[model samples]
Target chain A: MARMSTPPRGRPGRPVDPEIDSRVLSAALEVYSEVGWAGFTMNAVARRGGVGKAALYRRWPTRQDLFAAAINSLRTSGPVEITGSLYRDLTQTANRLINRFLGPHGMASIRALVDAKIYPDELGEALDYVRQSTIIGGRKIVLAAVDSGELPPDVSPSLIMDALAGTLVHRILLIPDTRRAQLAANPEPLVAQVVDLVLRGVGWQGTVSTRRTESGSGEPRTASEG
Target chain B: MARMSTPPRGRPGRPVDPEIDSRVLSAALEVYSEVGWAGFTMNAVARRGGVGKAALYRRWPTRQDLFAAAINSLRTSGPVEITGSLYRDLTQTANRLINRFLGPHGMASIRALVDAKIYPDELGEALDYVRQSTIIGGRKIVLAAVDSGELPPDVSPSLIMDALAGTLVHRILLIPDTRRAQLAANPEPLVAQVVDLVLRGVGWQGTVSTRRTESGSGEPRTASEG
Candidate 1:
């Protein structure tokens, strides 16, 4: 908290190796997603990534730094694109949210959100980006829909985002690890159900054709398609 | 997994002390919820509860056993009672879900669900009760509603349950600890918004009077009441 500015990455270490850095970053996420912050330790990351304690410490001085860097590394994937059509935009957003949670470090994000409640002071700046964005990430989607008159001006964007993210998280939490692969293989059905329900729940006035075009199935599919 | 039937409580040890047993159980939930399973240890529980290792082990021989006992202790509150009306039933259900998650042992339950994925075999039968119930708990509500023709016959109960549970969990996960008291002070507003949105989304054909009776507010308040 005392530091006024963000420190340069790999500052203390003697010019870090990209190969080792990449390995350590992946290892950090894997460890976090598996054991959570309570069980997260430098030793575990070192042992898992096959790197020495000294190397791991030098490259990233603190546990928070290492975890933050690992989280920031995922920044390349970027935010959900705002694709004009409210129905498609949410479907794509829901898909992105679900796919991300099921991704390699997806479990880490889910665990982090819960852990943040327990350990409020633990996360550093870079790590805070995902935590902060995830809650308000759908603001853009809501704004676009409201401006375009697809959704009511009074709709709570957070509710819609949570309904999507939380439903997927709940679904994922319920699915046994053994079946995750099968769900991952066919995410469309899950996405379809969630997106369609959310759209109707929020009273989206978007075109009917555009709504079903992306959503593979919903209760009204046969009637609408006919 | 190999057990033929549920084992008796205090089976391994001689009769246990109710005083120490209660302390140890509470301590186990605190430790698990605070640090999760990764950092969960008998020593921590012993220290937190101010009980000796010998006393802690006498009642619950294994870590899983101790944690299972701690989780099972919460069964005293019993399941959510089913009210006949769909609107009131869901509203009550949502409140119960939110209130439980906000309770002392609530965090432990949430954390355990995620950890179950990482350590599936670690959960003993007793502990598995909460996890199984949470996913399928709202079936009774759906059955009653469908029977009464309040909800469409084909409405997916799991979806409704997940949406309510997941949305509230998502909301709780976002609120900072500092603001939890403010949110907890009055949960009625949150319940109203979520229930109303979900009711509309699911195409509830229930009478307007009953739907808004429990829900304090929604966007359609003016038009409906008029």
Candidate 2:
């Protein structure tokens, strides 16, 4: 049994050919987006990539390997680079997260992975890769903000990240009318709104003096001085 | 084609059997939690519910019908009663939302629905049921808080509700370690944390008389407090 099952073979190399792997990854994304994870398979991916099954298998011996490679490729696709401003940094990150989920590749792969999470170890590593690289990247940006003094150090970065992302996800998943572009259009407004709410809720010692126009409309003044 | 379709044989005005439908919903929940949404089917639900497939079909007619009925049951599970205090009311709402997601029925259903949302229509309705019910209940609580003066009168209840629930969902989905029991152990601390954060973020004008303690010893004073 051991000999017959002896390690499935695949291509081995240092600087592996990006062209073949990239083609496979993109094709895998296409197939997943079209049919979702439950419908996705290596065979389909191979067909989509227009490569021989043997060649695809040689590169990724298991389904998990293929998925991992795809997620890794996605990570590289729009790796967030910080510009040191929390507002700008977060706005950009939110846009990226929303864009990915709304796109064909991101939506399909996400659907597939979520479907597979219930049966542990079947697609566990790939699921982990997806969560950490994308979802957790959202967390990291919040953490970076906290580390800087942009946010009050007292608040939990994880919770804030969850709240913001959750609201977006909740809207996407539930509200049929809400599109990705709508979310992207004003990501900063919601971010700013929540950040302010949370900071005040936490009793952040920072005093926010308001400078409102005397429009007499009685809107709570914007921060006169941060 | 018209004659080929089976007509409803049940007598008119016959009350639907609640007991059988309830049993099926329970069974569906169990199977979906164990096997996931993709693998769940009416036949499987029938087997687990201990009813004849014919009996299930007589009531639900299709997988979509069954899923929809089960989700509707979840919607009417309970309501968050308004207490006279803002803090207490908001805290209770948060607690309920957290409990629902972290609780056995709520979590499993949410997990299944998240998996199902990738597909169109049938599962989408089930997912939407979960999402909409929570948001509705959440908005009610926020409105009560505003009326009771716990929150500022001008505070946007929808935004607050979305942020509050969204934050909790994020924790449940991404940070698996935050369990129902932990929330139960001391929801007040988390509530206090969230409320404080949110209130501040909203720019709610209030006197900051209480000195909220920091969780750890890391230069305790915020820049503005002193």
| TM-score per candidate, chains pooled | 0.84, 0.71
Q: Give the TM-score of candidate 2.
A: 0.71
Maximum-DockQ candidate? 1
lDDT of 1 by residue, B62-139 (tens): 888887777766645555666657888888888887888888777777777777766777763544566556544577
lDDT of 1 at B211: 34
Over B1-226, each residue of candidate 2 has an lDDT whose tens digit, in order, gives: 2321212222233338878767878887767655455566888999999999988777777776666666555555366675544455556777777776655565455554455545654466555555556566666655554443445556666576666666666555554332535665766776666655555555544334321222233422221100
Residues forming the 10-long window of minimal summed lDDT in candidate 2 chain B? B217-226
Which RMSD does model 1 reach against the true structure?
Answer: 8.1
Cα lDDT of model 1 by residue, A119-198, tens digit: 77885344446645665558887887898788999999988988888888887877656678998999998788888778
lDDT of 2 by residue, A47-157 (tens): 889999988877887776776566556555444555444454445555565666555565554454444435445655455555555555555655655665556666666
Q: Point to the candidate with the largest TM-score.
A: 1
Could you report the DockQ of all the candidates, in the order they appear? 0.50, 0.29
Ten residues in sequence with the least summed lDDT for candidate 2 chain A: A1-10
Error of 2 at B166 (Å): 1.6
